[model samples]
Target: MIVSGMSGSGKSVALNTLEDLGFYCVDNLPADLLPEFVRRVMRGEDRPEKLAVGLDVRSGGDLGVIPDVLSEVGGLGLDPKLLFFDAEDDVLLRRYADTRRRHPLSHLGLALADAIALERQALKPLRQIADVVLDTSALNVHKLRRLVITEFGLGEASTLSLLFESFAYRRGVPPDADFVFDARCLPNPHWDARLRPLSGRDKDVSDYLEAQPDVVQFAGEIAQFLDTWLPRLQSDTRSYVTVAFGCTGGRHRSVYLAERLARHARERGWAEVAVHHRELD
Candidate 1:
């Protein structure tokens, strides 16, 4: 469990970063009120895999409640760590001003600066008790992302991170793809004048593309290649993968080929499948 600090302190960003690292997140929880919820979630269901939460003053200001929650966690035999995010009031103030937002504590008729100071004071007890404390004033987005990836071990991933991407020639490339192939060799139905505007999912288009022996062979080869190399790729612990398949247009041949490969991967019990048709719409 992570009980994050003040609003405008990048708590949400931290929480979301953890979520991407595969932590299920619960937000803005009161510290005093966490035992029952934690007990229920942890009991009768085993470890429930992994989970995280953001407990803070928006729910209640008594930091002492955290110790009780920790005690409950110890009693329940679930060790939950508390990470706190901190920043200079000036940095946080600038963040809020730059984003044109108000502090969560400001809703109580307090000035922004006053609210920040009050929140800091309220959370002081929690900070004294934190497992890892971060001063985010100097951490930009990249640094913050790295911190979450490093400290919580959330960013640790297997070597073979399979990325299935779909792209349009006009929109640039998929941001997270490991391997890319150009399916442009398959006959493009787009230039047929009649089929030019249709997508691969259309019955006529699917039939036409499926009729091409070359296209079937190409897809089969690609799938077979991935199967052989992916295991070794995993052994190396590669962080991300991107595969791009291009054609004259992204709609017909490339989409058909991509989907076919995806189906093959799924049938083989490979669930790390993500497919996008960059221009198929």
Candidate 2:
């Protein structure tokens, strides 16, 4: 598996998490060396069963070389998977804040937000070719761990879910999402204090909000959009796709919504869906 993501979006944490879960993890590796790296592993030069590596901007102009690298390894009889973790600007900023680490581009003395935006641009190619896109803006390590376990077939939700979550800044985002979103334009759930703390999972919250014509209308629109969107993702012949949910605090509406959405998708005959509340806690 190739663990790719933005510099501050838990790429390091996920590397360690994968190792804890038994992946022979390699970090910030030279992208040009991947094909040979696998060669070494297959020859018993490294751990065999589970292997993961980190790839991102540190590779410089060679950053775009990964897809070729992965393609080269394809005929080797391994169905290699590319897993990426990406989050919104603010969430990434918060993570950087909590960790107090410097962005790889900080040497330019550029504002953190701008640096992240630029980095996203640099990583767009990989995102387009990725088998999975995890938006981690609101996902916490615990939620992320659960997602990793569930989606990867290592947790209680054994069926495995290639789950992905979309979120909004006006709304909270998920802390454990493999994918995340910034939907500030959708609507704002923060105006109402009562609904502010309640997630989409609560009956009262759903009822109160759905009672509003706008909420019902928007829900239908988003649901329809995803129905078309998700199937395209699944048809890609890739391993899996996981979609997550997010709101302003991840505590109230988004969490509740994600749970219900997961259930809805499951009932509709989508294998099994795993739900995670990234910012709920």
Candidate 3:
């Protein structure tokens, strides 16, 4: 695993999470040395089964040559997964100010903001080739760790980690979603006076939705679609796949479908199914 990102964008935290997961962790290795290091690990009998390497702007000109080096690593029969961490410039600036650490480029007489921009530009090639791009603007260390574990934890040895998140359409779909199903077409439980105060998890709301033929059919078709195609995705070497269900309010229809889908996926032998009710939270 290769983890590279903007400076102060949680690269260290991500590497630490991988370390906790039993990966052989290396930080700030020069791009030129990556293939040699992985070659050694591949040849070693006592090395950890998984490896996590952290790279950042400090590598300077070496960053530009990473793509070729990574290609060479792949040539050696290692499926190197690259994960890039990204955050908004404002958030990065705030983090630096809170920590009172000087930017790595401060010696070049560049302001912090300029240095951040330069770092992003330098890292663009790596980001474009990343297998997974995690936006850390809204995540703290703990949440980021959970996300890392959720995507790359033990269950990933066989199947993809499945996540179902319910969100309101007005709030926008999650950027990480692989498939988005709109539950707004189903009957609106919010319209009922009795169910207005209840969420999809409530028995009353579930019953109301369960009574609707269209709702049942919609959910069934979704499950069937995933049943047929998820294996295909897993075969593609994806570590994680997130399917988001969205409704107008996200409290009723979307939440109901997300929970139902998660149950169905788990029943179908998906070992790592997770559900998130965004509006409920």
Candidate 4:
């Protein structure tokens, strides 16, 4: 695994989490050295079963070379995954203030905000090619740790992991979603006085939406589409796919469909199904 991201966006936390999960972790590894490092490991008699190397702006090399290096590692018969971590500019600035740690590019005499912008621009290639781009703007250390462990720790490396997330359309779509389905057209439990305070996870809300013909048909079609295409995606070597459901308020229809699809995916024999309700999490 190659971990790279904006500074102060929890690369250390992610590396630490991977370490705890038995990954032989290396931090600040230069990009040019990556292929050689992988080669040495592959030749070792007692190589670690899992390895995670950290690379970022601090690593002091051309970030653009990472993709070619990744391809070279793949040519060596190892499937390499790049995970890029990121956060909002304000969040990163606040973190630097709270921690009083210098930004990696601080030596260039740029202001903190400018350094962040420059770093974001410099890391654009890595982010675009990343198998997963984790946005930690709203995540704390503990939440980030749990997310890493849940997504990476317990799954077979060869199997594709599915993430079903529910989010409010009003808050904008999740950036990491590979597929986003709008659930706003379905029957909403929010209008019912008795179910107003209840979320989609509640039996009352589920029963209300499940009774609607539109909801049932919508869900079935989405499931059918996924059933037809998900296996093909897995066969193409995708490590993770996030399917997001969005509604006016995340508490009702969106959550219902995310939960329903997650169950459906599991029933189809996909072992790594995880459900995350963004509004409720």
Candidate 5:
């Protein structure tokens, strides 16, 4: 696999995850050297079955040659899949500010935003040919790592992975969510002093929410909708789907719905159900 992406878009994290999954990983290799490197690996007496290479604007050489190099590698009996990671411009800008890292193109006398724009334009061809283009604007490092593992390291490549996430509407809906459900209409556990400090994972909170008729009906309807549509989505060859639930505080209601839906998905024999509470995790 070839990993290429904008800087600060989690290429390092993806490479680390791939390494943990037993891939021999190399980072920032020049695009021009890829073909020769593959040839050397093929000639080695003990070649690794899995390999991952990272490339980006930092990789010196003509980026335009990448496509031909990939084709050349394929001709040598190696199937290379390109994975491009991206984020919204604002997200990338914020990431750069948070990390206090210089952009690779900053030395060329370009401002941070200009450097990012330049990198994006330079990487356009590679993105166009990418087998998968992941927008990481809404994903934390953990979520991105989980996504990589689900898509690549899972034993069965064909099985679809489902992620159920809960967030506060105040923080905004997750940009990557396939479906977003508002849970603000449900009972507010925050009003009850006893359950105020507890999250939806707590027995008291769960029992409280489960006791409400409106909550039960809402959950049931969401479950039925998923049951009716998820298989059709899977049949369409989607590798992953994210379902998000949002409420006012993101503590009780949203988390409970996410957890409940994950359990429901698992009970229905979906092998890859993961639950994440944004506020909690």
Candidate 6:
């Protein structure tokens, strides 16, 4: 496992969280030494079943070397996962002020904002390579820890955790979604003046949508498609899958369909189905 991100984006907190989850944790290992480090871990007299390493700008690591090293490790049959943490610039600035700590790049005589900008540029390569990019702008340490535990903890080891999310097509697709379904062709509730101010979760909006035969049929067909294929998908090594439903406004059709799918999955004995209404959030 590799943990990297912006300077104040909680890499240390992530490492501590992993340590609590029984992973052997290392901090600030140089990028050039990663290959040799992997070798040692694999062939050492005492090998840990799980290991996590932290890397950031302070490690004197060359960003250009990471892809090659990762390829080499992959050649050796290691399935390494990278986690990138990030936050909004203003949030990062606030964190630095609260902690009263100088930025790592401040030694170059750059201002705080400039230092942060430089760090972000330097870490862009790692961010592109990450399997998970966690945004921490609104998360406190405790919340982040809980999120890490929920995402990485082995409690649901045999089950595939499913996330059904609703989004607006105007906002583009969700980056992490495994399957994206378009609902713009469905009858929209936005045109209904009575339901204009209500969300899909509201009783009035739900009633309006439920009364539409086309909407009902769309939901049923999508649910059927998932039921037919989810088992095959679960047979793969992935632990989680995200199914996104998108409409023009995300206020009615998309949200209703996403909720309906979540319920269907649960009824089918999927114990870890979750619904996320992105626009609502």
lDDT of 1 at 234: 60
Instruction: Write candidate 6's Cα lDDT for 1-281 as tens digits.
Output: 88989988888878876885678999999988888898889898888888898888988857867888788877877888888999999999987875568899999999999999999999999999889999999875545654676776634465677788898888778777889999898788899899899998888888988998888898889888999889988897666788999999887889988888998998999866667777774
Give per-residue CA lDDT, model 3, range 1-281, as digits (tens): 99999887888877866775678999988889899999898889796788999877887666878889989999998889999999999999987875568888888899999999988998998999899999999975545656788776543455577778888999788777899999888899999999999999999999999999999999999999999999999999886788999999889999999999999998999866667676664
TM-score of 6: 0.55
TM-score of each: 0.56, 0.55, 0.55, 0.55, 0.56, 0.55
On the 0 to 100 scale, the lDDT of residue 106 in model 6 is: 96
Query: lDDT by residue for model 2 over 107-165, one digit each (tens)?
Result: 88899998998899999888888898887777655456556666777544433344544
Candidate 4, 201-268: lDDT as tens digits: 99989999999999999999999999999999999988778899999989899999999999999899
Name the lDDT value of residue 40 in candidate 3: 91
Model 3 alpha-carbon miss at residue 238, Å? 27
Worst 10 residues of 1 by lDDT: 155-164
All models: lDDT?
0.71, 0.68, 0.85, 0.88, 0.89, 0.83
Q: What are the per-model numbers of colliding residue pairs?
A: 11, 38, 0, 0, 0, 0
Clashes of 3: 0
Please give the range of 10 consecutive residues that has the lowest summed lDDT in model 4. Answer: 149-158
Q: TM-score of the candidate numbered 2?
A: 0.55
Say what the RMSD of model 1 is: 9.1
lDDT of 3 at 232: 95
Which structure among the candidates has the greatest TM-score?
5
Model 3, which residues run further than 4 Å from truth?
155-281
Residue 262, candidate 6: C-alpha displacement in angstroms:
37
- Model 3: which ten-residue window has the lowest total lDDT? 152-161
Instruction: Give the number of colliding residue pairs in candidate 5.
Output: 0
Q: After superposition, how far is residue 254 of candidate 4 from its true place, in Å?
A: 42
Residue pairs clashing, model 6:
none
Off by over 4 Å in 6: 155-281
lDDT of the structure predicted as candidate 4: 0.88
Off by over 4 Å in 5: 153-281
